[model samples]
Each structure stands twice: as C-alpha cells, then as structure tokens.
Target: MLDGIPPLLTALASGADASIPDLAREVPEEEWPRLLEIVRRHGLTPLLGEAVLPHGDTCPPTVQDALRTHRDYAMLWHRIQMNDLALILEALGGASIPHLLMKGTALGFMVYRHPWLRLVGDTDLLVPADRVEEAHELALGLGFKVTEEWADAHHLPALQRESNPPIELHHQSLYVPTPEPGYTLVPVDFSLLDAEAGTVDAGGFEARVPSARDALLQLSCNFGSHMEESIARPLRWVRDYAELLGRGRVRWSEVEERIDFIAPDLRTTVLMSLALARPFIGDSYEPALLEAIDGLPNPYARLTRVVSPRDMVHEWTTSPRRAWHVLSCLMGPWRATKWSLNKLLVSREHITRQTGLSGDALCMRVYPIAFALHAIYHLRRADRSRGE
Candidate 1:
C-alpha cells in the first residue's frame, strides 16, 4: 500500500515477511479497495487468504466471499484441466508414450494444495524429442486442432480443443540445456526427468512432475522471462516459488552448482527469481546464490532483477554510462559477431517464419528488406532517445 512504489509492483519483497495484521494495519480501510485490487491482479487471493484466514470471522464477509469465489472458480478450472489431462494421458498411455508435465499444471497437482488453488491456464507436457512427431499425430487423432507455424525452434506449436485450455506439446524446453565440447548453454540432464521426478497420485491415474530441485529451475526460468512484462506471470510465479520453497525439499547448494554450469546468461531468469523470492539484496537469500548472481560478467545487469528491461531502457535514454554498461554486459564483441553471423545465415528460416512465406527465393528477398526496416526503426528510436 506504499504510494512511492511503482504501480506495476503488486507486492514488494518485504511483504513476504509481513503478517496479515501488519498488512491490514499498514493499508488503511480506505485503501483496502486498492490493496484488494492489487492482490487480485497478482493472483494472490488464495495465498493471502491462507496467511490471514485465522481472522476470517473478525473481518468482513465480502473479503471472505471474494476469496471463496476466486478459489471456487480456480477449482472448477482445476477439475476441467484434470479431466482433460486424464483424457490426454489415456491416449498417450495407449500409444505407450510417457511424458513430463511442465509449469503451472505440474505444480498445481504436485506442489500446491491442489490444481484448483494453483489456477492453470493450459496444459504444458514435455514429450521426448524423438516422440514429438508421434505426439503431434496422437493429438491430431484425438481431434486437437494444431496451431502450426513454420519451423518451431523450441516446442511443437500448440494444439487446441473446443471449450478447453490449449495443450502445448513440447520437445524442447524454454531454456535449451545443451552441454557439449563447445557449450552454449547447459543445465540438468533429461535423465533427471524420469530418475529424479516422481509420479503425482491423481486419484486413479498418476502424472509426472519434476523433482523439487528441477522445479526451481523451471519456475525461475519462467519468472525471469516474464519479469519485464506487467502481466500475471510474476505474481503467480512468486507464489509458486513460495509454495515450492515452503515444501522444504530443494537443496540450494545443488541448485547453485547447476545454475553455475548453465551460466548467468542462461540462468538469469532463475537468478531474477531468487532476487524476488529471497531478495538477495536483503536477508532471505543464501550467500551461494548471491555469489552466483554476482558472478555474472556485468554487475549492472542486477538492476534488471528489480526494474524491468523496458524501465531500464528508459533509464538508459537519460544516462550514457548506464546505457554503455547494459550494452556491454548483454553484448560482448564475440557475442555481437556470432549474432551477426546467425542473422545472415541461420536467421533465414526464422525470417521465413516471421514473414509466413515458405519459398526460399521469396523469403531471402523479403528478409533483407525486413532487416533494413528493423535497423531503421531502432536507429530512429535511438535518435529520439538522444533528443529526449
């Protein structure tokens, strides 16, 4: 309820440490409307409710009614998702294909109280890379409408069903952990999917969820990517981390080692997650993780954990030194060179996808024009910034 804090920030890091009475006392009754709206926007109804429900009878029924309403709505979606998941799993079982559930859906049944309170929007299931085509076929057989685009670099394009959340069948994870002689990015081994992860007891059937350690990575990766957007991702994601951490299963040291292997550029999302969760600047986070965050080549990159990339860009417009630091941290000479090479060579397929043009001749012709326009747009934006 602090006025000075950015409107985009629903809950500050310190709020995690504050009790419901403290929150209620700090946010006066006149401000409850705004506070409630913030909590609602951040998907924190159940989380906040759980913290303060002991005083339910003392408080107004409207607040209780709101919590119950949100929980009821979430529960309905949870049942629907479970049913849909069962149907998909049954089909996959018949086809002898095993899969791992990812993100909110996985965390719903496994990490949280139930899938209902967690509020999943869609089902994200990771199938083995070899089985992606087969899974795509199975989805088609099950009458799912495929939302295909050209050359999906990561996961297979989403497939949809009527009146149900869309299913995204993934072959590649959001952060591709490719460890090799010439390593670009590396994290955990896929073997951990089966070996470390356990099956969730979903009444009659079971669903697979990542080990607690791995869940941290997934949660962090998802959080890092979405932190800049003033969307519900960070709100729900923060609670997810809280829930997972509360379970008391994750080993921070092991998690740190794996994060170190991936490098901060790849693990930046998780690092940002830790900053929000533990507030590395504060006391909640461990020293090792903080060390890992500090180990990133550029120290200024840490500012991104608190403020968004867009907000930082605004700051860059006013300050040359900060701008230079950000540019240098994100783009070294070697990375810049590799990026140019990729744009000239590997970007052709990506360009084709962007343009929705299939033929090589047409795509190649359109790409240079697209690149030129993109460059011009950036240059104009820079010039405007200089003027500002």
Candidate 2:
C-alpha cells in the first residue's frame, strides 16, 4: 500500500475534516514529525492545527509554518486559476464558439459552492470536431494563439497568449487514437449551443459554464479515462462529488444510468473518489456503484494513489507513454500493436510538418535522432521489465 502521506498531511494541517487515525496508521512514528513539519511549512496549520490532536496534544512551530504556507499557496493558485478561466471564457465568448466547459472549472461553477476550492490550473473547452478549426481561428482572432501543437490531429492544440491564460481546445471528449477499432469517445450527442448556458460572476466578467449533468459526465471521464496514481485530482473530484451530492440537484439514479450508457466502466472513477474521500464523505456511496467499482483490475486500482496535480494532468494532457498505456489496456494485444505502428507513422508526419525534414533526410536528421531517444527511453524500460 502506498503511504497516504500527502492526504494525511493535508488533513492534519489544512482544516480538512476527515478521519486521520486510519490514515495516520499508515505512517510510521519516526516519519510523523517530518510529515507534520512539511504540512506546517506548507500553510496547512489552520486545518491541521489543534483540532487534529486527540487530547491536549501540541503541534511544533515548524508544522504551524508549513500549514500557513500551504494555505497561502492554495489561495494564490486559486486566484491565478480563476483569472485564467475568466480570460479564456472572455476570449471564447468573444469568438462566438459555443463551447462546453469541462472538468475542474465546470465542477467549480456547477457544484463547488466556492470556485476557489475547485483549483483549476488551466481551462479545458470542448468544441465539436467540425468546429475545431473555427474555434482555433476564433481564439487566434481573440489574441489566443497556439503555443504548442501536438502531432496528432486527434489531440487538441494548446493555446495561450501574452496576457491571457492557457486553454486546451479538445475536439473530442476521449482521445482514443485511430486504427484502434472501438467506439469513439466523443462528447454527449446533445447540442451545447442549445443547452442552458449559465453565467458565473467572477468579480469581473461572467464565465459561461455547461449544464450540471454534462459537467458531472466530464468529471467522470476525467477521472476514469486517465491513469490515477495521483491523489490531488481525485481529491478535487471527491470534493466536487460531495458538494454535488449535498446539493441534491442531480438525481443519483439518473447519474448512474448515464454512467452505464456513456461510460460503463466509470466505476473506477467513483471508487478512486470513494477510497480517498471516504474520510471526508464516509462510505455513504450507493451500494451498486461500490460493488461494481471493486471489480476493476489492479492497474485501475493504482490510479487512486496518484496525488500530484502536475503528474495527473500530464497523464491526460501530453504524456505519450500514458496515452499508449491506456490504449494497450483498453484494446488488447493485437489491436494495440496496430495502434502503436500508426502512432509512429503519425509522429513522423508531425515531425515533418513541424520541421521541413522528410524520408531519408528525416531519418538522418536531428529531429529523428531526438524522436529515437524518446522512443528508446519509453521502450527500453519495457524491454528490461520483460527480461526481468
């Protein structure tokens, strides 16, 4: 079992109301002071302060400082995220691209009563594949230009500007590569333009958000589709779920039915949230959902432990290795091989476009040399593991 270091530390010093004893049991006595000191320095003291002690227990000064720092960092990051979200929404709205806001920001607007707690690092927008080019042009027209373009057309291009925040324009909901014969993971077969377009008054300009149900599905896909070794993103999902459940706006039965139809294996997503957030929300999750989640394989189970937001985001956003891993797991052996070959071909085309190098010239070029290094690094580990 991975020691629940990050979560436990957060709970103790961050005013995170949860059962810490069970989590504390996972930490060795010798490591407690170190963990406590880290949490205090990180500004989690308000949450992890006196309330955490059993009876008449005292905290060290170092722990206090860490907690304060954590709170400060969190507050600063939330402001940054909020500002970015506002900027992106303004740009998109100006472009007239009817977009569906997804994941963290969507959850913040719909579920998390306080948007600050949702903690979005960047903005994610879903536009239909057909409108993708139009959306890109519109963003550029509004001063947001493509910062980094991925080689695959299936992937969204990363957009940013000098003064504005970054926006990821997703053409599809789930990016399952081509040549992998399976159902396409597109967005809900409903018109986002006609959906109830609510606005969020974020002090300056109002930010448009998606419907509650769609936001829920996006969050479900965000958690379910990616590797879940990090705790931060899953924890954010748990917070969103708890708030959504508490509000009682969405019918539990309806959510479950959609999960069955849209994302059948979303049980993994629910389980990871339940496991990490159980301390805060308790085991009040629906019985059927709990049972289904328990049946997922070990790899899925390992995702619940992922705690760093950066790592979790990279797994979904840019990591080629993670994309390949997810494809291999979902599509079996034979189909995955074909998918891998197709990816190499696509990568070659991507390289060619980015740099004016092709064929034999490309093979003998520096760009190909770098690509080879990346491929070798990715494959070499697998080769060594097999030999082991």
Candidate 3:
C-alpha cells in the first residue's frame, strides 16, 4: 500500500496534468487496483482521475472504466444522501427538533466541491441533550427505526429508514472515551458552536453547519474521539481537514479562543490531526498553527506518523484481527492498557449485545483467554517490526 504513495500523494497534492498511462507504468499491474482502492477510500477517486486525465496515464481500458464507474456511484450516493438529508431536515423542522446537520453533509456542500463528490453513509443530526428523546420520537414518527443507543456517548441513538439514509441524532458531536490524558464521560457540548452556525439550503431543505472555525475545531474533536475509540480514522478525514484549511474563512484567532473557552484539551487534537494530514493533503495550515503542531511533544502527537491509519467499522462484529491491529498500533503500554480496560469493563455490554453472553464468571473467563492471545499477537508484531 505504501509503495503506491508517490502517485497517490501526487494526485492529491498536485494540480499538474499528468498522463495516466505514465503513472500506470510506474506501478506494476498487480498494484494498480490496490492504488485505485486507496484513493477511492480516501474520497479522491474523481479528483485523482481529474488530476491524471490531462497527463493521460495509460491505464488499461478496464481499470479506467472501473474507476469511472466507482466515481459515478460515489457521486450518486452523495446525491442520495443529500436527498435524504433534505427529507430529514424537513421532518425535524416540522417537529421543531432544533437540529443541525453534521460532518459529511455540511462539508460536502459547503467546504468541498460545488457538487460534493464524496459518499455519505448516514446523515448526522445534532440535537440538544435535553431534546434527544423528542428528536428520537420524531425520527420514529417519520418511520425511522431506532437501531442502537449509547447512553454513555452523547448521541441519543441511531435511527434508520429504508427511504432515506440513517439519521444519527446526536446530543454530543464529540466523544472522548479514554482517560489517558483526562476522563470526561459527558462528550463535549456542541451547543456552544450553535450560535456561530449559519444555514444553507440542502436541496430545498434549510439546514445549518458550524462556521469554519467551529467546523475545524469540531472535526478535530471528532477525529480525536475516533482515535480514542481505537477506530482507524479514515483518510477522508485527512481530505476534509485539507479542504477546511484551504477555505479562507477560517479565523485562527476565533478558533483558538473557542478552544480556550469550550475544550482546551482539543488543542492537541487539532494539532495532531493537522500534522498527520499534511503529508497526504499538502500543507495549507497557518504558520503559527504549523509551528504549534511542530512543537507538540512527541509519543502522542507522533502516533499518526507511527501508525497506519484506516477507517474500519467499530462494532461487536469486528474481527479479532482488528483488535490485534489496534492493540499493536501506537506506542505500546497506554493503548494496550486502555484496550484491556475497554475489553473488560466497557465492552461487556457490547459483547452481550452481539453474542448474548452474560454472567460475571463466564465473561471473566473469556477475558483471560482473549487478553493472553491479544498480548501474544502484539508481541509477535513487535518482533516482526523489529525484524527479531
């Protein structure tokens, strides 16, 4: 995967017209499709193709057609998600849910390309904690089914409907599950940013997104939460951060002030994500911000450089392989200890939900075996990375 980095990074960071045939020649046939998938997962399929089209790489006809097809489907999904967003906004409005559209929807429309080329799975709706129940009921009234709920996390739960994309009614936009630095059970209040939110028309559905400063801050928090969850923060996030920085609207002064005001802890979150994103997305950060990122103490800030990030689903169904991957991902002790705590304490209910396992003795028994195997796997990986 790393071998394809040159072309992939060129596609993302450069605007030059390139021959696709020439780029293809650099990558052996066996590695081309993998390269395509990497760019596609990073939400750069069409953009990469656009970058290469002028130079004209001699991509095999079939490979070119496949990328074209993937690009078309991604565009179509974006449209469908928008249509779903419109219906959802209309429903929430009718119910007076007082919700704001989060992440993909807002970024796709406002920060990204005019047509919004990325794919959105579910539309995230931010509702006040006090009104989460009302919003959940509203989703139910609109024929959406409640699929899951997490009281610990600020999100009320998830709602899905066949007619539209799934709606996640969020009481909290950002959640940090680990206590390595500090423990805050209540996810950060996004209402603080609501005042700065401005409305945009989402295919005739009036919707709101945070101002540029808040969006960057909020995205930073979300990225931090995903990392805390031991979930691979996707490359798409890197793209989003890149584009958000490119927007001239961001006010660093206001953003830093808010960080001081609302969640000063996210100072590192913002710094780290920016540091990690620059390699793939070319640097667009302010000089002060770049200096701040550079000055961040290592061990934590440098995790992005040490780890291979991927966006993998986090659920009970995720394989043991993923657990091992996360276990071995960053600097050892902290992540390892946290994984064990989550497995023993935080994950019992998750395991029960997935496997119907219950009782203290049985669960504790399962933990010993799982922990030992995970430990062994981590050691083996360390040995491999060390060539021992």
The best candidate by TM-score is: 3
Give per-residue CA lDDT, model 2, range 1-388, as digits (tens).
1144356644532223555545655655567676664433322333343344442223444544544555455456556656655666676677676666666766656664455444454567777677778777766776677765552343467676663345787776542222343224654443643365576666476666665654665665565543311122343454566666534666456666656675565545555544445444444456655565566566555543443332332233234545445545555444544444333424657777887886656655633344344555534422321101
lDDT of 3 at 251: 53
| lDDT string, candidate 3, 1-388, tens digits | 2332555444453322244345655776677677775565444576665544444455656667776776666666667667766666777777776777787667776776544454555677888778888877866876778754433355666676664456677787754334343224435555676888898877766788877887777677666555433223256576677667655567556678878887676777677766666555444567777677778776555565554433231221124444444444543644454455343323656666765666654345456565655445444432322100
Error of 2 at 48 (Å): 7.2
Model 3: runs farther than 4 Å from truth?
Answer: 1-4, 13-30, 49-58, 114-116, 149-152, 180-191, 228-233, 247-251, 302-305, 308-346, 349-388
Best by lDDT: 3
Residue 53 miss distance in model 3 (angstroms): 6.2
- For candidate 1, lDDT tens digit of each residue in 198-249? 8887646888888776777777766543332233234566567666654455
Among all windows of 10 consecutive residues in model 2, the one with the lowest summed lDDT is 379-388
Q: Give Cα-based local distance difference scores for all models.
A: 0.56, 0.51, 0.59
Q: Any idea what lDDT model 3 has?
A: 0.59
In terms of TM-score, how similar is model 3 to the real structure? 0.75
The candidate, 2 or 3, that scores higher on TM-score is 3
